[model samples]
Target: MLIGVLLVISWLILLIRYPTKALPISMAALAGLALVASWVLWEENRDARYLAHLELRLSYDPQQCPGDRPLAVRLKNGSDAALLELRWEVAAYRPGNATNLAQRLYESPRYSGPGELLPGASWNDCLPLPDLRSGYRPSTLEFRAERLQGQFIR
Candidate 1:
């Protein structure tokens, strides 16, 4: 921040003392600033579209990896940035019928680890589910990361 201010002051002083030479410098700086800002905004906007295209696949055999989720999610970085600080949610619910509404049974905390989700790359792992009664089923699951969003419904 200090360096940026100093650079701006220097540039302004040059512009005042040598107007012709400083015009090119000023133009170049403006172009560079616009380029950086546009790039940053593009990246930020893309984040809102995260997880929107997340793909999911599963192989469940309750018999294997008991008390565990059998779900796998694939995230293809279709953007120009890396994803980090990723987390997810797993929810279990009892189907609703008659006068009963869907009953929430389990929800996991933000699960995170195993490095940054990079551009054009993917990360995957299986997480354990809480012991549950037969009446409940894994209902909805979601994942989040920088500019990412995805959910699985069963």
Candidate 2:
């Protein structure tokens, strides 16, 4: 980024001092290339989070969720960096870590904030559950995709 800015500034200075058309064009091209390279590098590295920073909670309340909506989740941002995007899933798992999923929301619901999912900010919403029984037993095996509300690590 600094290099790109410097290139642009140099181009501006050259345009002021030297009135040659080819010189200005060459400097402008170099500046544009620098800008593009910096943007590409940022895109490739910015989303690679160094550590896990997503917090999720599942809830099922008859009063809070009427009708077919029996599952919901609250997502909290607990990272130092703003969450630019999220690839989230909701699943059910047994004690052995076998699992099933109910609903999945990907990068479509883009955060309106500009890379600013500040710490402690949370989002809560109801989820659609399908083919899950309320009377599930602990002793028996069951599929869990429907009642699950979140996946790990974005």
| Model 2, span 8-93: residue lDDT tens | 79877877787697586887888999999999887545444422455656555446875555555566777655565454434544
Query: Clash pairs of candidate 2?
Result: 100-145, 101-145, 102-145
Worst 10 residues of 1 by lDDT: 145-154
**Candidate 1 ranges beyond 4 A from true positions:** 43-50, 55-64, 67-125, 128-154
Candidate 1, residue 149: lDDT: 44
Looking at candidate 2, what is the lDDT of residue 150?
A: 21
Clashing pairs in 1: 47-147, 50-147, 50-148, 50-149, 51-148, 51-149
Each model's TM-score? 0.42, 0.42
Q: Write the per-residue lDDT of candidate 1 for residues 56-127, one digit (tens) a residue.
A: 332333454445554444445444456554454433333343222222354533444335655566655554
